[model samples]
Target: MITMVRNVSRWFKVNRFMGKCTVIGVLLAFVAVACLGQLASVQLLNGKSTAQAATASRTKTVTISAKRGKILDTNGAVLAQSVERYNVVADPELAQTFVPTDCKEKTAGNCQQIDGQPVGTTGAAAVARLLAPILGMDAKELGALLSGTGQYVVLKKEVTPEVMRSIDDLGLNGCVYGELSSERLYSNGTLMGALLGGVNDEGAGVAGIEQMQNAVLTGTDGYKKYERGGEGVEIPGTVTESKDAVDGSDVELTIDANVDWYVKKVLSDAKEQYKADWAIAVVQDVQNGQILALEDTDQYEAGSDDAKLNTSRAVSQTFEPGSIGKVFSMAGMLQSGAHQLTDQFTVPGTITKNGQTFKDATQHGDEHWTLAGILEQSSNVGMVMAGENFSNEQRYEFLSKFGIGQDGLGLPGESDGVLTSAASWDGRTQNTVLFGQGYATNALQVTNAIATIANKGVKQQQSIIKSVTDANGHTEDAKTGEPTRVIDEQVASQMMNAMESSAEHYSKFAGVDGYRVAAKSGTAEVAGSDGRLTSIISDWSGIIPADNPRFVVTVVMKDPQGSYGGLTSGPVFKQISEFLMQKYEVPASTPRTDAIAVTW
Candidate 1:
């Protein structure tokens, strides 16, 4: 009985201890609930909990590409443009099991044979058979692609919209689809090709103005984000974000299409007649520096393998300018008051300095020549005699002022033709440079130098781009720099008069029937395959309507078989000058004259 009582007492004590622990546990549970409630309140005040935010909404975003800009001539003629194209893509795994809508009605084992294909064929075979004719693809080749396990595959690219429309009519969405894209199209084929440049497969500009101004021509692409439904369709009115694509701007070039086309024709003719390796030409407005025409025989067709070749020979190719460079030295001499148009010198047939003898292209006996006569006769000996009047430093300054050894008129790949400073000039180098040798210059630089004379000693920055029109229809004019006076107006006039004498007395081929022309012709020796000076670069540059000074045209033909600039490039300049006069309806300012004397 005592043992039973002690057991009951211990059991009571155990029960009491258990009750106290249970109460303590309830208090701890209450504290945890209160803490959790406070945390929940804080989170609710901030907006959303991390887990709830993650599961709150789902969105799918899609990118829309902006339309690439158009490259247009000053006349609004499209030079380079983006054309709408499509890419044929497929989900190969899905396409392998996809059934055409037309075949759906023939579920009784004949669906694979709907297109007269083999029976019991794979879904890919059926799809390929139906699409081959419309897509202009080989059925067997296409079937191999469709039967692949890849989820994404590009079947074809750059298909026309009409073909894409026809494919859409087939209702093969689950198997094949068309993605909208763009490809550049050149309307003129190879005309102004190098200047306009070409685009790559990614629809980005790769060369010429297309590359230089890509950022301005390439617009911003936008996107739209919206919630998707269970079936993968966008839920109605559940768009989370949206933005419109900005189309690329329109690049209006300074090139006049009509004049440029004519110049190209002339260049082509010169290339054919001269049988030369290459030809280049440039026409600039003296007052404004607008490049009316820039052409080359090495032009390439856009998007063609030929495009990989260098095409803008006018800006890219440099050569020893030969006699044409003499004009700048003459201008500099006159501007510096070192010489006058009336200064006379008895020029020997040849002059020697530093173990080098300088002679005119054509040998002649000693003759007396006035300043004008020196230029009219294109006497290298006379040029050398006058070159001694200026120090080496002064001569170098003159060349620099004439735009030699300067970065070209803002063109890609334009060479800053080689020019050794006066500090490095030797006796032979000095005399050679006096008549345009020992240094290199591109066709445009030569043209710019002559244009400076035509502009009455002012140098205007040359420009090929006229304006840029943005997507919003806003047009920005080209920032052609202001004209900087480089010489006295009187000196420029005297130089022009002497050039007129040259055209009338020596370069008769450069003169127009009714228009006064001031011009110079040059022939420089180019090494041939035999390592001898058997090749020549024929070149001519001039200003028309000498009294009024309207246009400056320069032409170059390299390695012509048997001709000089007066024979090959002169006619080209004349034809183009006549066209420019007629196109602009320019009136004859001064009657053509032939009274300029080459000798006393």
Candidate 2:
């Protein structure tokens, strides 16, 4: 019995020990299963989100600026262009977290001992000290910039690519970077400054041709997005997204840079020689109305504040056309069958009719004059007498057809010169209109008006831009409508003959030796700075090689010492006409056998 009881006790003790082992095994199994679930949750269910979070901490995005297009002259000379440059930028937050490695033996990394001296500091201070010399910035100021909480700051702008490379070699990890940028460069300085216009701080066109062609001149910006390492440097092969920038299309103007340069010089010299307040000149191709050169005395440097403030005066300012109006009126008289170029008149120095008195520029006795002589002498009284048969509606019809008071060239700040309807004309204004005193017009209008006769009574739309070429090499010519007929072809020839005799009047001072110029001169009294008629606008318009017209040149001067247009602006007309003939190798005029009888 005792042996059996002992056996039972032993068995029960063994079973209890086995039960404790089983319980511990079950607990261990439960813990392993729990760990497995947690591992699955972390490695599978939330893995993508976790990885994205880690990347978010180091990812960086940078803007890549597109290069702006160029403005080219007719000869493909660069007028305005963009030069590649860089803006040195910094992640101030990253710079503030930077810690340099200790220099025990010297390694290929930034070290605490910069320039062989223990940098006595950490974080932003150490970075600024190393970068100060390279960037030519004060260490203290640089440190202040790097210590800011902002993610990005521009340390310097418009640095050359060479300088940008030097900064990159310093390797402040990802704390410093270079952002692609550009600087606008005007190669010709103030040559066509106000006309070429300028860009703003953000590289947008604000005036002149730059503003007019902003859509073609401005390029779309791009971006670069990538992941960076803890050192703030882009990891190898980590560029996640990027787009190459599309450069802007190039604009080619009709202006010949050489011609424009010469014209500007001539005008500048004339402006000083005459002691004029300002001067403007325009040269147009009679066939196409392409403006070869447009210049003014108040030129400003491109990309300058003056360029922003001032506009091209050639299309902006207006003045009474004076005797230049005689040509239009004479054309009207001939076109309307009111008078013949040979019709005789005894023009007195002054005349009074309808309670209005009119006089010539110089006091003179009665002179025998024909219609052609009246124009050559720019006789206001003769015009009044010749226009006696011209009705008011016919007077307005001719002026309107000649493009007076019309929108010009579409340049910025261009004005449609003032011209009241003929029905509104008073007695004096009626006579004044016949000789070019009661209305106003700009230089371009005067140029085109003469060009109308040169082009056989057809009017061509004026164009400054010649063509546009895109990045892929496609080109589009400038758009212009068909020419409009303003006068009969035969009438234009008759007027040209009459003008040939008129130009002879300026032979002493304004004649081009080889070219037969059909020209007219005008002098008008305008309001001065004091609002009185103390200022004089002297203007001359000439069609060169009158027998076979090629170019029309118009010159205008304000407050000139030489008060007469024939004296002040006429010489300028000669110089420009000679240049055009020589440059284009135009043949000399055939003898003027078709000259109209100036005196019958």
On lDDT, the candidate that comes out on top is 2
Q: What is the TM-score of each candidate against the true structure?
A: 0.85, 0.91
Compose the digit string of candidate 1's lDDT tens values, residues 1-600: 999999999999999999999999999999999999888786776446664464344465756668899988889998888888888877686677765443455454333343553434547886687678878999999999888886667888989999988776655544677666778888887888787777777777777777778888897888888775432345789787889989899999889988988999888987888798888999998888889899898768765655634546778888888888889988888888888878878898998877888888788888988878898888888998897776777788988988898975666677888998887877688888888887888988899899999999999888888999999899999787777888999888888888988877644666787788899988888677798987788898989888888899999888876567777888889999999999998888666453444566
Clashing pairs in 2: 174-232
- What is candidate 2's lDDT per residue for 390-460, written digit by digit as tens? 99999999998899999868888888998899889998888888888899999999999999999999989
Output the number of the TM-score-best candidate: 2
Local distance difference test values of all predictions, in order: 0.81, 0.89
Clashing pairs in 1: none
**Residue 197 displacement in candidate 1 (angstroms):** 2.1
